[model samples]
Structure formats: C-alpha cells, structure tokens
Target: MTPPPPPNLLHDAFSADFEHELRFTRSVLDSSNPLLEDLLGWDEQGPRPGLIAVVDSGLHDATPGLSKAIEARFADPALPELRETIIVPGGETAKNDSNVVESVLSAIDLNRIDRRSLVAVFGGGAVIDAVGFAASTAHRGVRLVRFASTVLAQLDAAIGVKNGINRFGKKNFVGCFDVPVAVICDEAMLETLSDRDWRSGYSEAVKIACLKDAPFFDLIEKNADRIRERDIDASRPVIHRCAELHLHHITRGGDPFERAEARPLDFGHWAAHRLESITDFETTHGEAVSIGIALDTMYSHLAGRIERSQADRVVEVLRRLGLPVHHSALHGEAILNGIEEFREHLGGRLTITLLDDIGRPVDAHEVDPEVIARAADLLA
Candidate 1:
C-alpha cells in the first residue's frame, strides 16, 4: 500500500473571549424612577443615542396611551431620544407571525438603528422574543432593553439571553443568543394582565423551585393562595428569587449557550414544548409546563427516582397555584413524539432532567414509554 502521502494539514484554533454585563432591575420605565437615566448614561462629550420602541399591541390597548408613556418617560436629556414607537402583535401570536419580526427589522433599518442605538421591547415573553430576535440580528446586534410586562417575562423568559421564533410547527426553531443590555421588570405593568395570564407566570417559578431550591418551593407553596388572588406583595418576592435563580444558572451553569448534552434547567420542557405543538398552541406555555411537570414528576416516581410523596407534593403545589396538572394532549402520540424531537434539539444524546427530590434534579438517558403512558393515565 502506498504510504499515505504526507498529509497536507492545517489546524487553526483560538478562543474568543466574551463578557457582557446585564442589568436586571425594577421600575425602569416609571416616570419617577431614575434607573432609566442611569441605564442610558448620558455623556456631554458624546452624541445622544437614538431609540426605537416596540410595544405589544395588547399592551398598547390595555394601557391606551402607552406610546405617549414611553415617549414621556425617555424625555430626559440623559436618555436616548425616542425615534419611533412601533406596535406589534402580542402573546404567542407575536412569535407565530414572521411579519411582526420583519416589521420591527424594517423599522430598525428605516430609522437607522445602529449598534449604539437601543431597541426597547415592551411586552410579554413572546413579543420580547420576536422583537429581540429582530434586534439581535439587525446590524449584527443592537443594544436591547427589555421592559418585562408580565409575570412570565419578569421571572423567566426575559431574564435569559436567547431569542427565537417558531417554525415548521416547532417552538423556537429559528433563533440567536444575545444578552440584553438590561431587563427592567416593571411590577406596575403586570397589573393589567388577566387572571389567567397572571397565574400562568407562576409555573416557571414552580419549575425552578422544584429543581434548585426546596425552600423556595416551600415559600411558593405558602403563598400559592395569595398569589392566586393576584396579591403582588406575595408574588413579588417569588418573581425576584426565581429570576435570580435563572440568572445564576445561566452565568454559573458553565454552558450559557447550551453547548452541553445535559440541560438541567430544561426540566419538564420536553413534554411542554411538544404539548404546545400537539395542541396547536391552544394551550399556553405556562399551562403546558405545569402539566408537563406533573407528568414528569409522576414518571420520576414510577421509575423509582423519586418518592410517590414527593411527586404528590409537586402535583399539589401545581394545583394550588391554579395551574393545570393534566391535559388531554398528554395522552396522545404526538406528545410522545416530543421526546425524540427534544433529543434531536439537544443533539447526540437523550438527556432529560427529572427530580429525585425537592431541589435536587437528576438526568436520565432513557424513559420507558409504558411508564410514561401509565403516568399520563394517572395524571388524566
């Protein structure tokens, strides 16, 4: 055999260092609050940065004069001049429409939004995701300031550095990861949410509490009734703690981009994502997550990873929080297809996060379909 000709080889490897500080605070858009000024950081020597605002259409309707509010709030000399206030569809519908994202991009280009300019997205999680995706891809990436207007956005979705839109009936199929300059959780904005939207936000808190903090779970359990009553005093601390936990996991979890096979933070998400698709998204994400958590908790018990009592407690908390623990879609084959889709999304291995106890999560490579069926039956 002819010796393999001297292998012409060229290898190049280098590390690109990345460091970005994200400000997470409250009351950023409040007229009396001074944090927006600090966030803008005016310098007399430099030109003022321009800003383009994107408000959720639903929010605009609820607040009536929302555009006026944004313009007035950013009127300070230290703050960026409001160039345009664009309204986009809200909720999951916002993400479902590509036109919404394109409209924002068109606005960005037409207004000459640059890297120095800021894209302030004011809406719920879905609107934030759609607008942020546009902002991240526009001019490579422009500074983004998120005004988290709902419980879900404040505590979970808007806290992370990922953005996407669904495609081919899959959740977040097209996306990029770009950290926002700041995420301002305005507690006042959440007041306008319907009762269902309000309760929908707590499922994420329950999810994190189950995986990372038993004490936090206990706190939520204690406050579930008051939270269901729409008591902000009881809900504020939960939102804050949950947001902190998510930030810690993103920064300290060592894989900010999900470059690893094991995704501990995605507990209960496999079924949740699939359920959303199977149901044609008739079920909201938070409600689906609550049901997914219930199913996974049951599976964990059946698989002998967690005690039946532990599973019961999880289901109880979800019920107390007014979250649904069972859905008709959970029993369908399309829902089971989510397991493989989730594995494909993660790539290489099938790693699923399941709880062995409160505040402690364990990863499993395989799940028995029979057991999953039984768990669904029990949930049903």
Candidate 2:
C-alpha cells in the first residue's frame, strides 16, 4: 500500500458581508419626494454611474405617463444618468418567457451597463425577478434598486435576495441570490393595483403571522375587511410587519440560503407552487398561497401536528380576507409532484414545515399522501 503520497491541498474559507435596505414612503415618483433621487444620487466629484430602468408592462398600462416620469426624474444632475427605460412583461408572464430576460439583457449590452452601474426595476414581483436576474448576471452582479409596484411586491416578494425566472415547469428553477441595494415600498405604486391584485398581497402577511407572530395574526384578523377593501391606512402596519418578519428571518433565521433541512418560511409553499403550475399560473400566487396555507393547516391537524381549532382559525382568516381556501386540482394526485420537485430543489431528503399551533412551526421529514387526501377532502 503506497502510503498516499503527500496529500496536496490548501483550504480556503471566507465570509461575504451583505446589507439589506428597505424603505417605505408615499408618492415616490413625485420630484419633491426625493426618494428616488436619494437612492441613485451621485456626488459631483466621483465618476458617475449609469442607470437603466425596467418597468412592468402591466404596471405601465395601469399608470399612464410612468415611463415619462421615470426618464424625467433620473435626468436630474445629482442622480445616475438614465441610459434607458425598458418595459418587460409583468406578473407570471415575466418569469415564464425567456424572451423577457433576453430583452433586458439586450438593453444592458446595448447601453453598456456595467458592474458600477445600477439597475432600477419598477414593477410587480415577477417583473422585478426577471429583470433582477438579468442585472445580477450581467458582469457578475450590478447594484439593483427595486421600486415595488404592488402590494405583494412591497410586503413580501421584493424583500428578499432571490432573483429568478421559471423553467422546466418548475417555479424559480433558474435564479440567483443577490442582496438588493434597496427595496422601496411606495404607497402610490400600490394604489395603481386592481382590487384582486391588492388583496393578493395579504396572504403573505397571513403566512408570516402564522409562523412567527400570533399577535400579528390578530391584527390581520381585525383588519381583514379594511385590507380587502383597499384601505392603505388599515393595511400599512400589516404590510410593514410582514416585510420586517421576512427580513428578520432572512438575516437571523440561521438558514438564509436554505442549506438546512428546516425551512420555516416555506410553510405552505409546496402545494402553492404545484397549484400555480397546474393552473398555468391563472390561480395567482396569492390565491394559491391562501389555499396552500389552509391545506397545510388541515394536513397538520390530520397528522396530529396541530389541533383542529388552530387550523380552523387559519382558514377562517384567509376567507375573511376574501382569499380562496380551496381549488379542485389540489383534490387530485397531480399535486404530489410538488413534493418531489421541492425535495430536488432543496437538494436533499424531503423536509416540509407544518404548524403545531399558531406562531409555532415544526418540520416533517416524511409526508403522508393519505393524510393529504383526507385534508383535501376536508377542504372541499
């Protein structure tokens, strides 16, 4: 046995520091607001960095003169030079199309966007994700500033380090993690959202409240009507709290990149992702999440992880908020594919989060299809 000749190896280890900034304000596009200006300000003495703006096509349609406003604002002397203003497909369409990513990349190449430059994305979550993916990969990551244009974007979707486009019939199959320079939640942009779009965001609030803060759940329960009615005053605190909770978990949850077997943030996501794929994304992420939450809660009860009363409270709150708690597809076996995809996505043995009680989450390594069938029936 030739004593394994002198092992040649050198170990390397280093930590990369990151900072996440989230700001909340109203009327962000107005010149007097100074929010956008502050975000992209360039000192007179330093080499000016360029900026390219990407707006969601859906949001552009809703807000007339939005492109003009963005161009006019970034034209200021103190802000980064506005190189181009591009509009991409919005909602899930942004993620579904490879052309959308290519479009943004073309603009980046044509305009010479660089590492020192910035990409300002003004849109809903899907558009943001698609554009963010483009910017992050361009020259190995560019600074990104997000102008969250929907309730869902402001409170949950845009408040993370993920930028992705879906492929191979899986949600976010292709993506990258780049901490954003800033995530701005402007009240004016959300006001442009339709009623259905508005209510879609609160389901995320319900999700965070269920796994982290029971008191927050009470607040949402109390304001479900006002939120559903599109009253920003009643919905503001819930949105902020949800955003903060998500940020907190990302920074302090010990598994920011999900390298562990426990994923508390994805409590109801397994079914939600499946529902979206089956429905061809017509179900809407928020509606699917509402149903997913209720389904998981029902499953938790059936599996003896949570009491019936707790599960009922979870479903009732979603209903009061005017969100769906059931869909016919979930009643079939096709949904089981989500579990396998989820396991593959996480790159290990299956791990799913289930509720033991409000504000308390437990991880289950093995899921019972029988219990899922029973839960689907109960939901029906």
What lDDT does the true structure give each of the candidates?
A: 0.89, 0.89
**Residues forming the 10-long window of minimal summed lDDT in candidate 1:** 18-27
**lDDT tens string, model 2, 153-192?**
9888999789899998889999988899999998888877
Q: What stretches of model 1 exceed 4 Å from their correct place?
A: 1-27
For this target, which candidate reaches the highest TM-score against the unseen true structure?
2
Per-residue lDDT of 64 in model 2? 92
Task: Report the Cα lDDT for residue 354, model 2.
Answer: 91
Among these predictions, the greatest lDDT belongs to 2
